[model samples]
Each structure stands twice: as C-alpha cells, then as structure tokens.
Target: MAGTIALPLEEFIASLDNASLPKILQVCSGVYFQGSVYEISGSEVCFSTGDLIKVIRIELLSVSCEDVRKNDKFELPINHTGLFKVVPDEMPYSSIEELLSLRPVGLESSLPFTFSSHSKMTFGTLTLGPGRALTVLSIERHKGEEDQVRCHVKGQQEASAEVRIPLSSRGEFYECGSEECFTLQEIMSSPSLRSRRFHFINTTKYEQPLVLSPVYQVHAIMNLRKNVLKFPSNLEVDVVDVTEQCKDADFVNPLSLTEVLSQPDESFPAVVEILECPETRSLFKCSWLPELNKNQHLVFHKKGTTAMVLLSSLKSRKTQQYFLVSQQYGGRLRRRPREFNSVYELYAASTRTPGLKVSVTRNCEEVEEEGLPALSVGDQLEIVSCTRMELLCESSKGNKQSVEALLCQHLSDPNDVDDDDDDDDDGDEEVKEQDEKTEVLLPLYMQGHFVEILSDNKKYRLSDLEKEFSLPLDVKVVSRDTGLELDPLVGAACLRIEASMLEPTIQASFPHRPDYCFEIPTQWLSLSVSFTKHPLPWPQGQPPKCNIERVTEVTDVFFYEFRIRGNTDEAPPPRPPKRDLSSLSVTKKSSKSEKKSSKTSKAKNKQKSVPTDQFSALTLNNKKRPPAPPPPDGLNDEPPPLAPRKLSEAETATRKAQPNTYVKMEQSIKNDLYDMSADVDSDHDYESMDESLVSMVKTAQEHIVFY
Candidate 1:
C-alpha cells in the first residue's frame, strides 16, 4: 500500500508531544491594512510585498439552530424566527455591506442624499437583534456620488400596537441608506407600530425571495465603527465538512477531460473549475458549478474591521478583482512601496502539507457554562451541530478487540484523577497520532453544560463580544463589602466551573458528585436556569426551590457533577414550550413525557431499568414501528396532572399529530463520542451520593454531544 496509514488509537495518541492542536491557524499574508478614525488619526496605511498583519474573521458553521418569538399579548404574531432575522418594512433586510456601518465625516445631515464617496451609516436593531442591542451597517460610497445624509429616528423595536401588520404584508423597506434609516435620536421617537403600519404605505417592488440566513450576516449594529479592509486569517467553526467540491481536485488534466467530453464522456468537464482556494493558494479544478461566479465576487475579511470588505477589482479592468492590493489607515495616504517583491513568506507558510489538519470549534448549544443552573438526570439535552468530527480510534479490522476494550474504559467505575486533565497523557496519546505536524492547537473550550443561575446582572456572554451585543450589561453595585469588590461581576458565581474542573482526585463512586449550597448571598438576584439544550424555559411567575436528592448507582465510576443553588422561599415554576416556526426553524421544545414512543422507547430499550409510564403504552415492538412522532413545541406539561384541564376531542387530535410533522423535517446526526454513556444518564431513584452523580451524568448525557 502506497498511501498513508492511520495508527492504532493507543499508539497514535501515545506518540504525541502535545495532544491538542494550535488555536491560531497559519499566519497569513495579503493583509488588508486598516485605518482607524480616532486611533490612527492622521496616519496612513501602506501595503508592501511580504508584509504581515493579523485579522479575525467571524464564521458560523451551524446548519440550523432554534429561535424563540415572544407574543406581546396575542399568540398568532409571536415572532419566532428570532428577532435578528426579522427585517421589518421600516428597514429592509440587507447584507452587512448595506445595513450597518457609519462614516467618519460625522453625520453631515445637511448635505443632499446622492451617491458619491463610500457612505457609511449606523444600523441598530431595537429590541430585536440577537446581539445585546443593535448592529451598524455601512454602504461603500459608489464612484460617482455626492452628499451626506442624516437620519433622525425612533428606536428599532416593533412600531406601536397601532401598526397592526403582519411582516409578510408589510414587505421590505427601501434600501436607502438614510431615507429609511434611523439615528439614535430618531429611533427613540418612532410611532406606534399599528398606527405606523396603517398610515404607512406598502410597495411590492422590494419583494425578493426569502433566502436562508446568509453564511455571515452582521447581527447587530454597535457604535459608529469604521470599515476594516482586511480579514483575520481564519474563519472559526467548531466543526467543518469541506469534502472537496471537485471530483478530482488534484488531478487537473484539462485535455483529458475535454477530450472525453467531446467524445461522449460522463465526467461533465464543463463543470470543472480552475479556481484558487483562498486559504490554500494552489490551483484546484473543482466540481463547483460554473454558474456560481465565485471568482467575480471578490470579498476579503480582515480582522481589524469587524466587517467583510469587497475586494472588487475595477470592473473596467480585465484582471481578477483585487488583482492588486493596497493598505490605508486613518485618512492619511501611506506611500505605496516601489518594489513588487513576492508576498510569499506568510503566503507560503499557509500552504498545507499532506496529512496536515486544521480546524476551529465554537459553542452553539443553549447549554450553560458558568451561571447555568445545574441539571438533574431525566432532562433531555439535544445539542445539534454541523461539525465534522473524525473518530481516530483503531480500525475494527486490526484492533477490534482493543477498540471494544477502549470503549469499556468509559463505563468503568470512577478512576478519578485530581485535576481536570488527569488523563492528559493518555488522551494526548490519541491526539498526537491524529493532529498534523504544523497544526496549531487552539485552546479547547467546553460549552453547553447547565448551571443554576447565580445572579442576573445580565451576562451577554459571547467570548468575543461586539457592539450589537452591547446591551448595557452594565454595572451598578451597592456592595456591602464596601472596600474589596473586584470587577463587580453581577451574576457572578461564588464557585466557578473551572474550580471543579480538576478538583482533587474525586474518590471512586463520586465522579459526578453534587456540590450543594443551602444558603447563599442575597446579592445574586435573577435565578435564571440556563440549558445547553434551550435557553431554559422555566415557567414564569415563580421563584426556584432547591429539591436536592442523592442516590447511589450500579456503576462505580463517576462522570460529572453540578453545584445547585436555590432559594427556599421560591417554588419551581411551571415550564411551557417556547414557539418556533418549523418552516423556518427546528422547534426547541420536546415533551418530557411520563411515557415513551416507539422511537424514544427504542433508544430507551437499551436502559433495561428505566421506569415506564403512560407513554410506554405507545412503544411498539420491531417491524419498523411507524416512526414515532416527534414531540411538540409550545407544549405545556399536560397542565398539572391533577384536575388537568381536559382537551376537547378536536384539540386532542391537533396535539398528538403535530410532533410527528416536525420530526419529518428534522433529523439528529450522531457524533461518535468517546464516552457516549457519560452524556446520558437515567433519572432513576438513587440510594446515595454515587447514584446521584451517576444519574446526573446520565441526564447530562441527554444534553451532551460531540461536535
């Protein structure tokens, strides 16, 4: 065999110097130099061959995610596609290029609105965007335009109730930068939505196809940020699936394919494209459809500017767009260098050697990390991701027995090590064999674990935050400690997740011990529960009650643990499912039934000891039981078992069949996890501490998923 071979899982892992890959991808060249308005002031940017710059590109790799829509008072108009995606008629839906940036000339509202120099404006979503508050959209001034535009406005939330209008009827707003734009001053003064819609006119011209969310759409508008001409070298995605868009990427035989095509060949030579990989500069004849016209759309994203720039080559010229690159900073013109030497140092460094692996990770689950409320088993955690993770375990052909043995390790009773990386060496061995020689191992992070809300000063935690999320998660402290208050972390947890990370080697049977606190400081206000599955939908009109129970389990090994914090005065509130428009999103809510359907039962069958309930009656045996229906969204727990409000015969039919409709639209993709059992635990009654932890792990499993 001439091809490379994969080593056994143990041997591969053991051979590594470091188990983890690098966080930063290869340093790149062709940096799009940036000019700052305030920071650089009079400075200028100049690009030179071989020069280097750092950039950050924000990339989202998810195929789908859940969004919630809260109905103000009515149920039908609940805006469930997520406020971010809603581009009301007031502001037409736009790409980041057109919706949210502002220019430095300062709001010269006096000038007439005309196309001239690149015009930048600010776009802030009124309580709708996903980021803290808003986003800024800017328009690059076209070559022949003149005039500054000013926008006075009202806040960007729903117009007053008077604006009684369905989004579809309203259509899209004009794509004018200011004619239909808003300013902080104006936004705060807009009229009622009902009156606004009723009085406002409707036009059919702007109706464009409702497209799926763009791969990268600026979510919110924050501040009057200038545009960035460059992009960071890497676009982050926790997982990726770049399965060669071409049939024979490396086998570029133009003549061979052309000859076949001329003589009745099936290779479809017309589809072959001679294109360059932006990251890897080598020419690749890919399988991309010729109609894509990717080459014409010259877009470059640089780190400094939190926006993507159009590297539009002058249309007048025949060369590829951006055939020549330049740099500019702060308005002052940096003199261009005389020599056109090769910019190959960093460029060549980015080229990949065979077998090299590079990738990025992100936390997409609604699960909590720090202030998330701890979860008990019986809770289902569904973490969906589009990451393409590879299993480097030994091949069944050669190490079938060893692979089985390795899997068994996860099931063994707790063999706890003191620190979080107790098995660092062991795990590293597997990674060593897997990662490439030059791969940078970015820091590995854990996301989506549930945690009890400690306090609620609103932590809009995006490891990398922007202005859109700039909702004043501001601070206001009335500290009793008077003197030594740190960053005044509002919803700060007294005990952090990292603290227990590598806690002293937990003894056997306590791998997932629960750390309980009976009483806590009153400073923590919002006792919000966070889910790695869905933004917790705990019922409202109630506080929380700590119902701590400990149980022993059959398995001696430990898996995970949670620290529960609760208030005795509060009672567990009722939970209602949040609505999601299935046509647009996969509803987040599924029932926690007292019974199991054939499918849930099939998955449940593996757990021989699970307690059965009314749902079990529906569980079918073999013969491909009609695919069990999916659970319903917006479902209320059969309204308090006792004196439950009975449903009418018609209402009952609607409830039962709705879920099956949803399941047809969505399918969960399974990731080959190292310890599949740990993420899933049964919420069975336990005898002691060991059982409680085991059960927690099992419950955690429902939420656990590998990306």
Candidate 2:
C-alpha cells in the first residue's frame, strides 16, 4: 500500500483498456450515501473497505455529458454523430513551445491551427498589432539550424504571406477559435481531447458548455462470492491496482455440461461441485435423479460413447410405461402364449408366424348348411393356409356359393398314441397314418375362443429376442438382474417390447456412490458443473469398477419424443377391407325366407324331418343332401286340405301344461342366432355365413305344437 497509487473507481477503470484487462482492484474506501446498500439490475451491491474485486470485463455503455456552467449532467450514446467545435482557451501562453506541447494531437497532425497574439511583436520586418491572428502552416528544419514553425499572416485586402518563427521564440500567444469539428466518439477515443471541454454546435437548444466522460459497465467477481458481480464503474468509491500483489487470488468459475465436454483430457477423472442443479427432475424419470443437488459432489469419470436401447412395458388399462434401455440388460425372457377370440385374429397371427398351432378354448357346434365345423374344447388345430370352400346349403334358387376359409388339420391328442408296435412301421407308412388326420375348414366370420400353443421352453436375451421376433411381442421375464439392488422388471407377469433404439450417452455417478453409475444421454438431458481440486474417492491411478445401470424408468414423454424424431422405419399395417352392408342385408333376407320354407315343410311332414340331435354332429365335408324330386306337375301343384280332429280332455291338459316350456325353447334358439350374426357383423369383413344351418333347423320345430 505504500507504493501503490489509489484513484477514484471511474479514473482507474478509464485508464485501463481491453488489452490490459482482467485486473484485480482493492477497494481502499467505501462510498455510502445515506445507506451502505445499493440496488442495481435487481442485485444488491455493498462494497466494504479492503474488498478485493477482480474486474474481468469492461463495456462502454454511454457517454456522460456534464454542463460545466450549470453543473447539470445527462447521458448521450457513444455513437452520437453530432459535431462539436473547439472552444478557445482564455489563458495565454508565454512561449511557442508551450502552445504546441499542449495540443491534443501531434504537431504534424495539428497543422494550420489559428492562434492570435495578445500584444504586437516585431520579427525583423514583420509587425503584428493587438488581436491579430496567425496560422501555423508547417514546421521548418535546416542542417544545423534551429527548428521553426511556418506561420501564415493575412494582410489588408485578402493578401496573405508566410513567415518562419523560431521554436524557442517567446511571445504572449492565445488560442483562437477554429472551424475544425469532431464527433463525440472521436473526442472520447483520444485521451488528450477527453480532458477538454466542448459544446453542441446547435446553441439554440443546448446553450451550456459540456464536459464529456465515458460510462463503463464493469463485470467483476468478489473473492467471497461464487457468482460474478456486475455494476457500473461510476460508484463514488476509490480503488488501487493490486493485481501484482494478489497473483494467487481465486475466483469462482462455473462451467455448463456442454462446456465441460470442451475441457482437456487431463481435466477429467476429477471431482466437481454442482454450483447449480439441473432442472431434470421432470425431464428424466430415474431413481438417481433426486441425488443431484446444489453443493453435491460428483466424480466426473472419463467421457466416452455408450450404445443404448429403449424398451417399453406393455400399455394396459392400469398405466402406460417406458424405459431407457441399454445393451447391458441381463434378464431372460420367455415367449408368452397369445390368445385369439375370432378366426380373423387367428389369420392375422398365422401371417406372422407360419405353421401356427392353436387349441380351442370353448366348444363350437357344427352347422352343416352354413359350412361351420364342430370344434370341441382342447382340440388342437394346425393352420395350413387360407382357401375357398363350398357350403353344403344352397341358395333359394338352388345355387352353391363359395366362401373364404382357413384350411387346418385337426391334430389328435398325444395321450391317445398308437400301440408301440406301430413305432417299427416304415417311414412311408407313418407318413400315410399322419395324413389320415381330419382336416377342418374354419370360416373367417366365425367367432370362437382359441390360444397359442407354445412348445419350446428355451429362454432368450432381450436383444436376441428383438432380433428374432417382431414387436410388439409378449414375453415374461424368467430371470432377474443379479447386479441390480432392485429390478423393476422382476415381478412383472408380462412385458411387451414396444420399441428399440440405439443412443449415445455419457456415464456419470456421484462421488459417494462411484461404483453405481447412471448414463446421461448427451442428446437428452441438460446439466452443468465445475471441476474442483477435491481428491478422487479412490486411490491414485486406480478407479473402482463401476456397475452401470442399464435400464432407466422414463415417462411417456420420452416415447413421444422418440416418435417425433422419426426413428422407426416400419410403416403401419394396411387396414382391413370394408364390409359390404348391402350383401349382408340380402343374406339376412334369404335366411328369413329359408326359415319360412323349412317351417312349412316341417308342418306338412314332421316324421320325415331329421331330429336336431342328428344335425349337431354334421361336418362341412359331409355329402350334400340330394335335391327333392320336382312336383308331379311342375307348373302347378296343390296339397290336399287337412281334416280337423277333436282332442280329448287328457291330451288338451298335456298341451296346456307344456306351453311355456315349448315357447322358451323357441326364444332361446332365436336369440342364439341373433347373437352369432351380431358377432359376425362387428368384424371388418364377413367372408361366409356358417352359422345359418342351426337357425334353419330351429325354425322348422317352431311349427310343431306340444299335443
């Protein structure tokens, strides 16, 4: 402090420039007007005596103009384009050397400047009266001769002459007003001119003389604070340049995560403090996110690339879920059997997994006229292909119709194996026996319960399963990750591999739990931290082997973001063909007409009609019924009228006792046909009407009375 020069804060900052920046200043005295606190830009500023401030940056804000006459001050932009003329100095100079030395610019650049003499002086033949003006044109120098200034003198009647004056010549010289003009920027940029006073050229509005000074916004940091402090340099405090004395001063410098990546290699593998916590609680749903807090320390392990995959849990009515998956998944998954409710679903599954085998879950009664095959619960069927088949029943006009059907082989139960002696049979003979199995045609419109039959019990890795099967494939985890303390997928009954992705991430962890690391996807999460001198948690040259968390729980937002990025290449499956409502209505009408005819025929001859029990076992492959022989007279044939008969009292009582039961049976049959038709109509396309056979048989029985 003995040798250092202390100046007002403004003057010290004004003496410095950008090239000599990053200066450290010690506040020698504090300025307080009524109070010690000052608010600037929403931040409190209180500078105490001996406070050390490290000034990192200085920016020109505006030019402060003070009216010298009235002591009034105002601000003007640094880019002001208005010109100002130099005001003459009232004080007179005693010698020519003093006048030239006091100029704002070099003598060579300040040529042709006017100055008037206060008293007449004679230089040989030249004579000047009081208040006569002379302009200095140039400087003259001869060999071994003293330097002199070339002066221009104007005589009477617009005549002018030049004369040389010695540099050491003594005279009472006064600066005269000149026509030269300068902008505010030009005056502020020159140190010598900055000290001079000026006034606006337009005197009508601004008649007062002004003294211009620069205002600077200083960006400084205090030794006791963690954030940089910014304030204007016009404060009334005084400071001294102590940068040389405080060479070891430390200032807080925080870096963002993006900036951390720019740090050198040797800077990594070091400890760091979180000056500002990241707002990632909502962005990433993970177990470790809550651990990130301000002032918490982390071990910034070396940066590298990591390949990751995204797995999602099956969306259910309970909750939809997502995950940030990695290739390090250690669990095993087994394929889960899928269930089907209709033949359409079966066809859809067979297209993906050819040669699919399924077992019927419910019994289906056969309808021969409609081509529906009988299927018993637990019956096994192997789907071969889709084909067209002709129905046993004919149209009203006696024409046959073909419909789409699934060709399948009804497999026999394994428990009912042939005798052991058949094992020695030739391969050809065995093939022939296998081919003898019954083949059934399932109509596309038929609705029945069925489930996939999974025979293979092999386990598969998640990555391998994704490559081998198409998603959304259903699977159950057979084994849990032994490395993880708590595995989310452990107790899940079933999970669907909704989608997969390959991502690049940064592996990071806290210093307390260095061995347990979580990946920070460089493309997703945003965070910032600064390296500290704190030592590593482990010994020098040896870092503990970390167990990285491969799977991370995420929200549906992550899934939506993945979709928005257009990462998937699979197009949507084509929609099913639209059903023809007109054809369906026509089929309903034809069935109604057929029902009427069957009822009339049954009423005419009940003994000749087959019983309902006999029709239940009929199959689509059965021989078609021969057409009834044409009437004896094809043109006109009438049946004889029935003879009325009287009933006995016992017979009449029996009919009255069973009337409710008979009517209930008829209503049940009608409801069943209506339900079957409703299920078929709900589908996108109806390829066949195989359930009509049961409706025809039930209708014929409605005509028969109990007695």
lDDT by candidate, in order shown: 0.23, 0.76
lDDT of 2 by residue, 428-509 (tens): 4565467546788988777889988998788998789878876556788899877777788777767766666665555688
Best by TM-score: 2
Per residue, candidate 1 scores C-alpha lDDT tens digits across 503-613 of 111011110111210111111111111001121122443323322111111110111111132213533222221222452232232432423465687775654445333
Residue 488 alpha-carbon offset, candidate 1, angstroms: 33
